[model samples]
Target: MESLQKSLLVTGGAGFIGANFVHYWLNTYPNDKVTVLDALTYAGNKENLASLEGSSNFKFVHGNICDQDLVEQLLQSGEINTIVHFAAESHVDRSITGPDEFIETNIIGTYSLLKAAKKVWLDIPKEQGRQALEHRFHHVSTDEVYGTLELRDPAFTEDTAYAPNSPYSASKAASDHLVRAYHHTYGLEVTTSNCSNNYGPYHFPEKLIPLIVTNILHDKPLPIYGDGKQVRDWLYVEDHARGIDLVLNKGRVGENYNIGGHNEWHNIDIVKLICQLMDQAFENDKTLIEKYPLAILARQAKSEELITYVTDRAGHDRRYAIDAEKSFTELGYRPQESFETGIRKTIEWYLDNDSWWRSLIK
Candidate 1:
């Protein structure tokens, strides 16, 4: 690939995975310009990108992807050659309760962006068509679209037929199909990556790792749904960010990639591990034990006692694992953080960045 100058637009850049990607991209390509368009919803926090406020190469725009005018205006600037689409209603539980937002954002929002990209980047300027070919619309997706797997079944590969069970995954599945269709029909350059569960800094507290960590800190119940045996492959957020970078730059056009940590753990096991880690942290660090009065009491009383089993979520999948061999072999991409190392880093981040998460919790 030739070294062409890149001006990128990253959607959902205020959210967990997207913020990490924004940080990673700027650091990796310091000279390149990046425009971040985020809706700043409940899940998207401006504090996540607070560090990049003064950088000349970074610009943040508060907007929704579903707004065709806003999306078109950004693309028409003729600066964004790469569009990393991460905006979506991703929580399965929320999707079940009210699927309207999921459909609006995940399905319709994606179509709007694709349409805008096709028109602004591809449809106009017949003489500059070659330059347009270099523009990439990279769709960041999830592994849930493959549905659940049996305990003994193989992990989902890039070729796995999408069998989305929940509204969240179904909407994502629809968006994924739209991306591929645009590539095949309009010849718009596009690449898609379906990643497993991501855990790391700036993670919303509603997810598994953050929820368990926060609950343990406050001496609250660690709620486990069903038997808590639902297995999910967990990828560290930074590693997923790197994988996205790889796919954007080197992945084959009109192709999809599976990005995973290759580390699968049951939900209950993850909660238990967080409890054990918290216990150890409390024992080793007197300051932590002193900082949170509730945690100190819980440490003395036994943190594991807080575990509570709740009813399973509606239409919950039993397991999800991704086979990322193709990405590893083709794009020279591999996760650097093991589950143990990643979890420790995540816990440490939460311990140190109390204000960052506390504000969100309130």
Candidate 2:
């Protein structure tokens, strides 16, 4: 396959997974022009992309995906034939507390982008008697849209029925449906990937892995909900980026791919693993003890002592696993990191980058 020099408009490029994707794209294809549009929400931190500010091929735009006019302007101005849509309200807890933002951002915001892309990439080109621009609107989504699974239940495939339980997942499901509609009804070139849980550098500390690593450093309680038996398939953020790259380069339009790490673990087991890793880190480095005096438990090689059981929240999904055979066979997508390697990398990131995650803590 011929490699195409891409001009990409990456929405939500300042957030955790999004920021990592931007970094991966720029590093892998230095010549490609990449533009990021982000709202700088609580979860969206511009600091995540601070290093990329000096890159000649990178541009960051402060804007909301809900602004159709702004999205249209950007698509036209950059001649962005590829849009990597990553903007969405993704937290399940936040969705339960307030679902309005999820619906507005995940559903309506997606609609806004689709409208803008249709106009600039398709409608206007036809109106001006120009050749149709080769374009792809690749929507990044989560496997949570498939809802929970039983212990013995089959993992979620691209063909899994939608059974979202939380407002966040429901909104994402709606947006996924809209993306499919655009492709089938209007002939818009589009692809969607439902990815497993992503963890790595730049991940907001609110999520499980980072939260435990951070809490361990602060000597704070490691809260486990409902015995922490809930299972999830973990995907490294960079691996997810690689999967999307394959999709853009060679995937079939109107198809949905599942990107997974192929590594599943219980929530409690994950927390325990981090505690063990933290203990090892502190043991290996005496400076960690002096640098983070509050990490007394980790220093003592007893971080698990801080573990505290808590009542689980309502509508908590039991297990989520993704079957990525389709993505693997069709797009040559496979996660490069296993849970052991990925989690260790994640812990080291938090240990070395205190300045980054510390600023986010209120």
Candidate 3:
């Protein structure tokens, strides 16, 4: 990828995928600049971006994306020409527990950003508009937009219709439509990527992989919904970040790309794998490595000891797979990390970064 010189606005840069993408781009291009606009919600973690604190090229604006005045001020300013928005309430469980926040942030916030950009990009004064950029609004989205698939169903591609099952996904679908509308009616240069499940460092503890890891570390029972047969295409955080970079820099305008690792696993099986990996991480300890590492688990363990089945989430998607061939072919994208490599690294990150997530539980 050729390095481009530009300043970009990132909403929700404090969250997992957004933060990872922010770090990825800044490190890849030294001359480029990034100004982050985050609302600092419960899921947003400012501590994750603490390393970029005083950099000349990085600026953190502590505010909500839904605030039209703030969003308009920044867009109409002279610095930014590109935007990668990832600031949505992403947790399905939390969306179930309380959905009002999701509607407020995901739908309303996205609408405000679009309207602000349309106004400034098209109607601003020449003095301000001369600073206008070949702007692109890259919306980072999820595979849940296509809803679920049957066991033998083909993977979801860019053309898949929206059939979101959860409130979180439903709200994302609405936002996705808004992005598309901005492109068609207002001619906003935009792209959308609906990706599979992502797991990696800096992830909030409320998520599945981190939740399991934290609970396992605390010797708590790892909870699984239903029989745990729900399947998902697991993509690494870094790989997902790279995909976003490709879409923003190289993908065609008004296009939607589906991103995934092509690695699929049953939920129950993944849990067992984590348990076995935890045992391996605990290997040097004198307590239990001898018995578990007797075999490096190719699949997860059946340790009835740690598995606990809970009530299934209402409207849970049975399976989600992504046919990411377009991104792979057109954008020259391939997952840099395999599931095995990614999962091990994810486990290591949790082990190393205890202090960050420990605060969340408090």
For each of the candidates, the C-alpha root-mean-square deviation to the true structure, in angstroms, is: 1.5, 0.9, 3.8
Residue pairs in clash, model 2? none
Where is model 3 more than 4 Å wrong at Cα? 1-4, 125-132, 285-304
* CA deviation > 4 Å runs, candidate 1: 127-133
Which tens-of-lDDT digit does each residue in 1-362 have in candidate 2? 12668999999999998999999999988999999999999999999999988888999999999999999999999989899999999999999999999999999999999999999988998999997688999999999999999999999998899999999999999999999999999889999999999999999989998999989989999999998999999989999999999999989989999999878999999899899999999999999988899999999999999999999998999999999999889887878888789889988889999999998875
Predicted structure with the largest TM-score when compared to the true one? 2
**Model 2 misses residue 334 by how many Å?**
2.0
lDDT of each: 0.91, 0.93, 0.86
Tell me the TM-score of each prediction against the true structure: 0.97, 0.99, 0.92
Clashing pairs in 3: 272-300, 272-301, 273-300
Error of 2 at 68 (Å): 0.7
Clashes of each: 0, 0, 3
By TM-score, rank the candidates, best first: 2, 1, 3
Ten-residue region with minimum lDDT total, candidate 1: 125-134
- What is the C-alpha lDDT profile of model 3 across 195-306, one tens digit per residue? 9999998989888888877777665677999989999999999999999888988999999999899999999989888888876667544443342233223113333366
